[model samples]
Target: MLNYKTLLFSLGIAVALFSCKNQETEKKTETKRPNIVFMMSDDHAYQAISAYNDKLINTPNIDRLAQEGALFNNASVTNSICAPSRAVILTGKHSHLNGKIDNLSKFDTTNVTFPQILQDAGYQTAMFGKLHFGNNPKGFDEFKILPGQGSYYNPRFITKDGDTVIDGYVTDIITDLTIHWLEKERDKEKPFLLMYLHKAPHRAWLPAERHYKEFTKKEFPLPETLFDDYTRIHPEDLEASSPDAASKKYNLDQPKSRKSTAAKTAEMNILTHMVLTNDNKLKDSTVKKLGIKERYLGDPTNRMSKEQKAAWDKVYDPINKEFEEKYPEMDDKDLMKWKYQRYMQDYLGTIASVDENVGRVLDYLDDNNLSENTIVVYTSDQGFYLGEHGWFDKRFMYEESFRTPLLIKWPNRIEAGITKEEMVQNLDFAQTFLDAAGVNAPDEMQGESLLPLLKGEKDAWDRDAVYYHYYEYPAEHAVKRHYGIATKEYKIMHFYYDVDEWELYDRKNDPQELHNVFYDPDYAEVREMMIKKLEETRKKYKDSEELDKQFIKVYNDK
Candidate 1:
């Protein structure tokens, strides 16, 4: 009995409402695809983490991630160097496959990275902070990265559009970029992949002013192997020497009255600071005061030998006058202490700034609702030796240099207060991230998915062993090129460069790895069994076929 016009109008309204409802449904479905955020810290260690029971440092925000989700106690890197580890994390492939075996090596970015896969799947991807792989980030939609080891204070970042040299602490700058990307430019219809990387507690332990005195009062406990003589296990010829010996011996502990004292201090400080800040430039006054008598500055033709006198003249002429003016009464010891304290302050100050920025990033994530959907992972390039093993730099296969701290959190998916003891590697992180996003990982990746382990499904997976290789030898740390296989119970290593040797440690009996048992009569059978397993692993992981032939060479050389 309704009129035709009225009936047509009612039908039109119903169609409009139905269309709107369908659009809303589609929007909800899009948002339901989980967003992913992966974060990392350079050279952060498990021993430094308060959550892992070492109470000397306060990393409350990093600890919060573990509290909210899961902490993997045994996460390790495949190649324990900065570039190689990062490459593995990006490509989910071993160093051999990634073409990044050392810090100086370049990465081949043509291969499928998890970010690229996510982007292909309609996710918007972005990376901010340190990306030191020395290749253009191919998969990310947007990226702002530090040029090499970015400064702890006022770092310089390079972007696809242009390079940006920002005037804030590095951590804060990275976080700011991340939040800005999230709030402004990101597509609301698509899920996001935000990578927030940090340069914290890396070499030179440069903390900010706030964290300067944070751990100053508490004496850091010396490592168990602090005084270990290399002659006992590793022969003197094979043992890697500390990089900071020049600093520690001449600048750190030596009396500074010697004419070359200031010069040595300045040199060490410059090298140390350079690692933290790429923009580090020595002041004229600092140079003069340090008595650095070298000035090959303008003469390209002047060689180090030919310019020695000229260099000495240029370096010391002003310094000598300054020295006479500044310290009429200062003795050798006084000058030494002054130089040592200055170096320590600058280095530790940088570390404080990094920690403060960490707090800032944590605060930002919390402020945004995106934190619930995000997974924050904090780790380092590799572990650093802070006077451990009498060393300062990394690259050795030792525990202090090899074991990095790994903290992860995903609010909705991961279970809180769970600690996984499975042996995990940095190489596995890429696959894990891809798995979390339900993306297909490429076949070239050597890592296995850790999703089940992260989710508290302990019985769902079984991985018994982890492998390690360090190829950059006779360079910075003088660490011999070595490869090793470690399990939950034992570890077997072979050093093939410089001096060929094999080392074995039964972790159940000697957890500290103080004694090498490759030559032990008690472990002969164990050694035989491990050798077979190691070969099998090498083949399975597609490691160099040369490893098998080199084992005998290692034994014969030793």
Candidate 2:
């Protein structure tokens, strides 16, 4: 009915409208991929999180994540060492497979990391904070990480472009870098993956001045098993009986002198910095009197002349006075206990800064309308023993050191406050990230995707047990080399350092793993069944061959 010119005009308008509509739809589809922010705190434990019903202290930021998403109740690590555990998380492989079994070992960055995969898949990936694997972080489009275990106060960062030392608290610097990247460098057209790792609450616990007085007025309640004597509970053959056990041991009431020979030696090394001019050489008397022992105390090399010894005596005089004042009546054990308390105060206080920074990240997401599209995850490198089993550091197969807190939040998906009791490990993090990005996990990865569990598809998932191995032996923390398998119902740990010791725990009856039933006459069948299961797990995970080789290599090398 319309004229030819009118008909042609109508068709042109319809085509223009369709084209605009298609462009809008394409933009919406492109933005549908979720942005992921993964955060990790150094040495954070499961029992320290308030969301996990920890009544001791508050972790509001960590609690918020749990409240808004799923909190995994039984998340653990394949290895309890810092570098090794981090390597496992990045590669989704066990320490043996990754060849990063200890802190001193280097990480192979050529391997595929989830961030690398995401980068390849057209996502902007940035890592800000501690990437302590001692290797260059590959695959990240932008990276500003601390060179090893960074300082708590005014830490240094190794940037992707250059080595620039930023002045501020470690947490503040990390957060600033993250916010800056988000505002300036991140691509708005595609999703972004940001790894925000913190160097808080590590050894020599140093807290910011603001939080220094946080726990000064209150005394943390000593753990119930503070006095647990490993008489019958732990086997003599266990790796916990290693010679280096003395280093990891802690007491509850003793204060140690902060100025020991080691401290003085460190001070003397820095004293050279105070030398006014190049012409001023270190005085021989000053050097000799500093109690700088070259070797054993009574060795001929350590012997000093009267004047030299006198100077040494003067330098050590303050140390002796401080030591005597700190522990006038207490023995070494009691003195250690006092030091532990002070250490705990500083350690827990450091966590306050971490909690505060976590709040900042959450607030940023909410303020920018990114909360709905962001998947937030909070966890730690590994767990630490806060006076548990009379220990202070990690690397043990014990429950306190093995389990880590894992919390996740995604506003568009996942229910709030729901806790999944399924056994999960750090190795699963890579696959979980890959799954979130709709990317297929690599075949070499040992972890299973947790997407189903997060999506409330528990019935459709098939996972029951998780494998663990700690291979760093004759190393730091003195925790014996061990391997084990943990299921929902039971746990079996085998210590191979000494007389082959086996620890079996019935989780349903002994959730705390207080009792070792490997020697119980009634559980003989159960022990055999668990051992068989352990063997089967080793074989299934392709760890048996490596374990055998490691056992032979350790003895042969020794």
Question: What are the lDDT scores of the predictions, listed in order?
Answer: 0.64, 0.72
**lDDT tens per residue, model 2, 402-433:** 88999999985888889888889898999988
Clashes of 1: 21
Query: What C-alpha lDDT, on a 0 to 100 scale, does residue 324 get in candidate 1?
Result: 51
TM-score of each: 0.74, 0.79
Candidate No. with top TM-score:
2
Q: What is the lDDT of residue 61 in candidate 2?
A: 84
Q: Which stretches of candidate 1 lie over 4 Å from their true place?
A: 1-31, 213-219, 234-352, 547-558
Deviation from native of the Cα of residue 395 in model 2, angstroms: 0.8
What's the distance in Å from true for residue 419, model 2?
Answer: 0.9
